[model samples]
Target: MQLNAREETPVVSVWMITYNHEKFIRQSIESVLMQKTNFPIELVIGEDCSTDGTRKIIEELEQKYPQVIKPVYHKSNVGAARNAYEFCLPKLKGKYVACLEGDDYWMDPFKLQKQVDFLEANPDYILSFHDCKVVDRDNKVLKEGRLAENFKKDLPQESIILGSLIPTNTVLFRNRVITCPKEIFSVTNNDTFLFALLGQHGKAKFSNDVQPSAYRVHDGGIWSSIDNLEKRKSGLNTYEQLYKVIDSKYKHLIKKALFTRRLMLIKQNKSVLDSIKYYINSYNYFYFGNGMYKTWLKSHYDLLKQLYRN
Candidate 1:
């Protein structure tokens, strides 16, 4: 679809990436359209050649909201990371940018306005994000309240490295606070990496008072669909890569995360060799010395029980 030029530049660009989101894309797009902001905002969608009818739906939306919706239809299915890095992010023409996946929708109409207002008032902060609700495919609220309930008003880069504290759909960050790093694409969880990268430029704020958005958990969700063990594995992989690329100050935090993941893997792993390997990897962190013997004994005991049962 050809992008319709606007008489005025958009104040915020909503970066959305979709692939096979035919079921939820409409709601996702509409939520952005419903946003009430005094400043102009554009929804820039990267439709990555969805095998389903996602592209068709986007086409219809583009036709209706020509001025507000700008979509780049990929000829082939480039994965989400590539779609965002190659197509979607580059097209953003706003002073601030927000993220929304095709499967998730915003709940609050003033979400963007509140975030932008806070950022404008507080120049020290580079990014602002709020809490969101977790819902099932049918929009049943599985969990209510903040995604990161324990998060401080001022976010630390260490907290981000430890876990995903910010919901992707609830984020509003400065457009060019830092140049998009190519290394982020190397990790499966690019959003987490991007947030960590952005955290370095300045402070990050958690808008706890703002209304929560909706985060959908479905079989089609890239991260949510996976089992707990696989999710931890993916997180471990992301942390490993992040540890190598991020600033030296953050390396310890990543290592601490790696240790925790390895310990968790030791408990979840069924294979004796894999469990032992995780135990060995856990030694890289300083905290490994604390109660590590208990973990080692427990892993061996579990393996012995499995062997006896067999």
Candidate 2:
């Protein structure tokens, strides 16, 4: 899409959440500034307390560009969960709120424009997200597509329930349709919770294009920065929490994802009967887990395996 540089820019509230992203924050902000669209932007920098010098750089940028950049700086290090809940949501003031975390950047100059144009034209969709380039700390390209790249026309509701989001940065949601309730973010994994909430109310749009935004994965990444033991335990805990927050409307999709997880876990641990039990009886266990469901699942799995093999 060819956008004229002199065109008037729409008022987009760029929501950027940052922790200790001193290495990539500057490039991230610069990517926003390089957009071809002519629109007044209110850059909302939600600074989760970083021990590193990230806050200082944001302060410097804000001071240098007084009109465009505004900050929501916290005194202490509020983790990612609390930061999104308390700092960013309340400060969001644009008709179209575009999220770009401090660690990620916009690769396409027309990205904001393409998304804004679609949202403005198609008023039905309350939320929209796109594919982003996966990069490393040194700005090396790891992958070229995003979560929804597989779904160009309509993202399967099943996929949304999978809760495998590309990155928070690739999303640009309408503020009118959704807001981060403090209750929602207080959970273990806030991002998926927020996305699923949007799914509950109205339709969401996803772009299948090759490159939309840039997501930098590094040693300091949200999940990678942790120690080995804690990472393993925390990941499983986060998964369970996400399984809890998923809205009821997409229960089936969530159930499918759960089944897939069960199968994978069983294969890894070599628990065949346990896997079958988890997969088949997830509907019964959706509200709460039960031992009876496990027995039923084992019987069902054995019968199916015998039938197929025979």
Candidate 3:
């Protein structure tokens, strides 16, 4: 729908970041344009100098829907985290903000409206997100339900810090609820940090009742493109960074997550020194009350034996 000139301000701003997503950019943009909302919404895209035809498609769409589409064509590639945190976020001129990657698209036309309605009625909640269908590169549904099915209706900020429970494409949050830390731009998993930061201000709701969006898994996708080991390491780094900056109450959870990732890495590498170092690190980070010491000792002992045998 064409944005009315009378409605100078947008109620929702769709933040999209794209790089070499020529194959999926059109679908993603069209999905935002197709949203059925009573209030005006603007699409703010961060086109990070794609090496493909992605920019061309965005240009064509921007011209067609000039009122609803606002494009930030970067002269050079600044990576996804920087594009979102530094460029696109500052350009958002809406009460609420929703995120949609260039490779992912919203399936329901009322996606924005549903989340907006929920956030409007619930003042205590800072953000609301729904489930999403996991799809392959060819748009085949690999999973039919929520991205994180184990997630509950009332989400804790600690859970968000440990892992990604909410799908990025399905989230609609109150704009300017929290000032994003400069540390966020340095992390690989900026979205997780953003959600966790938002969670700190108030509460988060998981709208299972809302229609799910599409989360595409392709080789070109950022997180999907990485290998399992690299993904684990990335998560470990993000958790460590979060532990330093996040509130003191949430540090324990981040530490627990770190211990788990370190244990996994030690097992995979089978290094005796690494296992011993993990045991030492556990003592420094985790207290005796959490039973972390026992778990670390047992795991390291087994790893030490295996390493000797090898």
Query: Which of the two, 1 or 2, has more lDDT?
Result: 1
lDDT of each: 0.81, 0.66, 0.81
Winner on TM-score between 1 and 3 is 3
Q: Which candidate number has the best TM-score?
A: 3
Q: Residue-pair clashes per candidate, as listed?
A: 0, 4, 0
lDDT of 2 by residue, 96-206 (tens): 888888998988877777778887888777667777778898888888765554554444444545564636787787776334544565355566666666655556677
Q: What would the TM-scores of all predictions be? A: 0.86, 0.74, 0.90
Better candidate by TM-score, 1 or 2: 1
lDDT of 3 by residue, 161-247 (tens): 566578888899899633567778667878877876676666788887778899999888778778787777677777777777878
Query: Where in model 3 is the C-alpha error above 4 Å?
Result: 146-148, 177-179, 289-294
Q: What order do candidates take by TM-score, descending?
A: 3, 1, 2
Assess the local accuracy of residue 281 in candidate 2 as a C-alpha lDDT between 0 and 100: 53
